[model samples]
Target: MARIGYARCSSEDQSLDVQIARLTEEECQPIRSEKMSGASRDGRTELAAILDFIREGDELVCLRADRLGRDTRDVLNIVHELDQRGAYLTVLDPHITTRGEAGRIVLTTLAMVAEMERRFIKERQKEGIAQAKAKGIYKGGTRRVDREKVLAMHRTGKGPAAIAKALGCSRMQVYRILDACEGAQTAA
Candidate 1:
């Protein structure tokens, strides 16, 4: 009868440390399953570890519903799965626990909205790319510091570190520009 908690984060800078701390305060053992993205596949190792330890009537805690899963189908599926396993989910910030009807409905609605928004963004991007291609225009522009600027600084006898400083980047960028400069001469 272990009350296990699962903590997830979208990126490195967004920490699950605080969520873990809260879970610890609640006397629950926290499993941290983090990723660089939310768009990946269905499962996470930390979540699996939490599931492995949960028993009937055991509670699963998270900071927010969004931290658990991203879309309607995914969230509902996960919630349903946990319920079938006799485990309850509690999201701290919104104070929603799937043990009640209102919480389930709220979670479902939020998931649906997020999924719909994601679909709309994908559709819009596709349309934009299609329009640009139809007009014989490139779909993307040069990098923030593309070839011309890199070459211009290098031709001025700027060293890698100095060039990186001038361009507000790093020494690696300077080396890349130098390599590109060498390749440019070969191409000519």
Candidate 2:
């Protein structure tokens, strides 16, 4: 059996050191971490990799239940996957493990709490945005990618991949900009 760790931080500005240290203290080797939101399973490539890497008799350790996931369905799916693979999950914060019945129950409860907390966070964020909008202070997220530049590159015979590489963006973004430009032209 192997002990593997997974650490996460919601945003790039956040640090994963604390969670990594805890997992290290637990003697968890080959730890994987990522900077991504746990609000959903989307874009969490490292977590997905860990899920695929774990084998039977392996242990997946994390610092907290929320570190695993903020959605109840996602958490349950992860646990079920581990169970089916004969692997166990160890959460250090509350010291819960899936190796026993009691631990399983506690883990489920903790996951539910985490999901609830996520919902509360979203609600609070929406309220904050609404308040800011009411005060004419909420402008929304800044657009980092220059859609006009992307379209210009495409119009100059640059392919989506080339435009994306030059602009430090994804090909999908380039395609979207080009598509939008085309749609605008057609509408005109």
Candidate 3:
């Protein structure tokens, strides 16, 4: 059984050398590393490659569960795949290995917490966006987006969905402006 090690750091300011050291101490053979944000599926190529290489009786070793994936759904899928293949996952610092029933339960709990944390972050971000919009803040520090072309597109028999797609605005914004245009037309 291969005990493959994985390491990652989300930013340039962080280093993977320390994680490598710890995993090496644990005798995790053939360390795979990446310096990229684990914010989503895009940054998980190395981890996914390692998982692909692993087979039944293989073990995946990482410094921590967070090191594996920031999003719970990501690792939960990995864990389920591993479970199906009769493979094991070992988090060195946490000292939890999903090689048995009890280990599976612990991993499941962590996955749930990870999912909850993800939802909470999304909620906070939504509220922050609402607050920013109320204060006339544009995302990415950009100027206010013009909706003129969007309006023209709508006046030409294009639906709000199409206008929104072309303008890169939300359907709600498109609907709001369309309603305003209709009201103006009626008043005139």
Candidate 4:
């Protein structure tokens, strides 16, 4: 049975070095890493690949339970999936594993803590934003896409997919921009 590792960070700016180093120290092979939010399972292709590739009797390792997922349901679902495949999960930070009944209990408690931590983080962020706005210092999120360029390309018969590809943004962003432009035109 192989021992595989998975590492993740929420955004592109965050570093996966620490997790990778720890996993490597544990002699985990074929480590999978990704830059995506752990709040949900969506858009985590590396995680998906790991789930699909892990075989029976293999151990799936991560630096921490939160690295696997922050939502309790998502984390439980992932563990259930691995269980169904006869694979086990090992969280290194607190050294919890599914190999024992006590580990399962600790893992469940940690999952709930992680979920609560995520909610607390969001609440803190919202409060900070509100305070900043009240102080006239909140400018909100920066726009990565050029609105005029998107509109120009759309007027020239470019589709949302093509525009998104060229602009280095998601198709959903392209659609929102185009839809907003159409709404503005209708209002005019």
Top candidate when judged by lDDT against the true structure: 4
Which residue runs of candidate 3 sit more than 4 Å off their true CA positions? 118-188
For each candidate, the alpha-carbon lDDT, in order, equals: 0.72, 0.87, 0.77, 0.90
Mind sharing the TM-score for model 3?
0.61
Better of 3 and 4 by lDDT: 4
What order do you get sorting by TM-score, best first?
A: 4, 2, 3, 1
| lDDT score for residue 135 of model 4 | 98
Checking candidate 1 for backbone clashes, the offending pairs are: none
Q: Write the per-residue lDDT of candidate 4 for residues 1-188, one digit (tens) a residue.
A: 99999999886568999999999999999999987789999867789999998999999999999999999999989889999999999999899999889999999999999999999999999999999999999999878689999999998999987997798665667788888888999999
lDDT comparing candidate 2 with the true structure: 0.87
Off by over 4 Å in 4: 143-188
Candidate 3 per-residue lDDT over residues 66-118, each given as its tens digit: 77776777787888888788888998866889877787787767766766776
Residue-level lDDT for 104 in candidate 4:
90
User: Distance (Å) between predicted and true CA of 62, model 1?
Assistant: 0.6
Quote the positional error of residue 56 for candidate 1 in Å.
Answer: 0.7
Q: Candidate 1 at residue 24, lDDT?
A: 81
* Per-prediction TM-score to the true structure, in the order listed: 0.58, 0.78, 0.61, 0.79
Q: What's the true lDDT of residue 173 in model 1? A: 51
Weakest ten-residue segment in model 1 by summed lDDT: 34-43
